[model samples]
Target: MKITSIIIALSFISACRGLNMTRLRPYDLTAELMFIFEDIDQNGIMTVFEFETVFDRYDSNVDGRVTRSVYTTYICKSDPVQYELSHYLFDEYDVDGDHFLDYHDYDNFYNKMDTSADGLVVKTEFVNYWVLLFQKYENSDIHPMSTLCR
Candidate 1:
C-alpha cells in the first residue's frame, strides 16, 4: 500500500476507536536510548542466552516455554505494570512456528528491530520492540494475534 493510503487507513482506524499510543522515539544517536537494554549479562548483545535466562526466569514450571500461564506468572512476579509486555513481545516475536521463542525467533526479531539497518540495535529498539507490534513490526502475535486486548 502507498504511504498516503496507509495514512488514510490509519486515520480511519483511529476514528473508529482507541489506539494505545506510545510516544515517538527520538533520533538514533541519542545518549540514553543507546544504553537502555535489560542487559541480563554484560555481554552487550541481546543474545539467545540472555533472552533464555530472562525467559526461564519467567517460565513457572521449568517447561522452557512461556505459555499464557507462564507469561502471567512472570508479569505478576516481575514487572506487573508491564506484565502485558511479555505477551506483546511473544505474540510478535515468536516467528518460528515453534509455539515458543527459541534462539531463532528472538534473533530474527532482534535483528529486524535493529531499524537503522545497522548490525546492532540500541537501547530504544529493545524497549519499542513490542510497543509497535502492529505497524512496522508486523501483525504477528504468536502468528495469530489481535491488535489489542479490548
Candidate 2:
C-alpha cells in the first residue's frame, strides 16, 4: 500500500511538473507559512509556546503525539498535494524515527527554526528555512517526486 501510494504521488507530482505547476503560488505559500507563526501574545516572533500550539492543533487524538496517519489525514482533507507533501514533512520532523511526533520532536524542530538560538523563531528565520527546504526538495535529483509545493 505504501509503495503504491508513493507511486501515485510521484505520478501526480510529475504531471504537475510537466504543466509547470510544480510550485505553489509564492503568496499562498508565504501566507500558509506565516500562519504557523500564530503569535498568541501578539509578539513579532514565535515563541516555543506559540509553536507548540500549532502542533497541538494537529494532535487530533489528544494523545500528545502526532502520527503520520493523523497528520496526513488532516492535511489531505484540505489539499491532496499538501497531503502528499505532509508525508515528507512528517518524516523530516520525526527526528527520532519513532513514527510519531511528540514534544521532543516538536522541540527539536523548533530549535532548528530558531537559528539565532534566542529561544524564539523570527519570521525571517522561519521563512528562510522553509524556502530552503522547498528549494532543496524541488531541485533534488535523488527524490524527483519530492517537492515542498505543487
Candidate 1 residue lDDT tens string, 1-150: 699999999988864443222222232322233334446555555554565566567666675556655555565575543333446556666786566755566567667767776666555665555444434432222213322332
lDDT tens per residue, model 2, 1-150 = 999999999988876554222544463375345645477776668888998898898898798998877777776675554454566678888999999999899999989988999998877778777777555455333223343432
Candidate 1's C-alpha runs over 4 A off are 1-37, 42-45, 84-86, 115-120, 127-131, 134-150
| TM-scores of the candidates in the order shown | 0.49, 0.72
Error of 1 at 117 (Å): 6.8
Leading candidate by TM-score: 2
Looking at model 2, report the run of 10 residues with the lowest lDDT sum: 141-150
Clashing pairs in 1: 91-141, 91-142
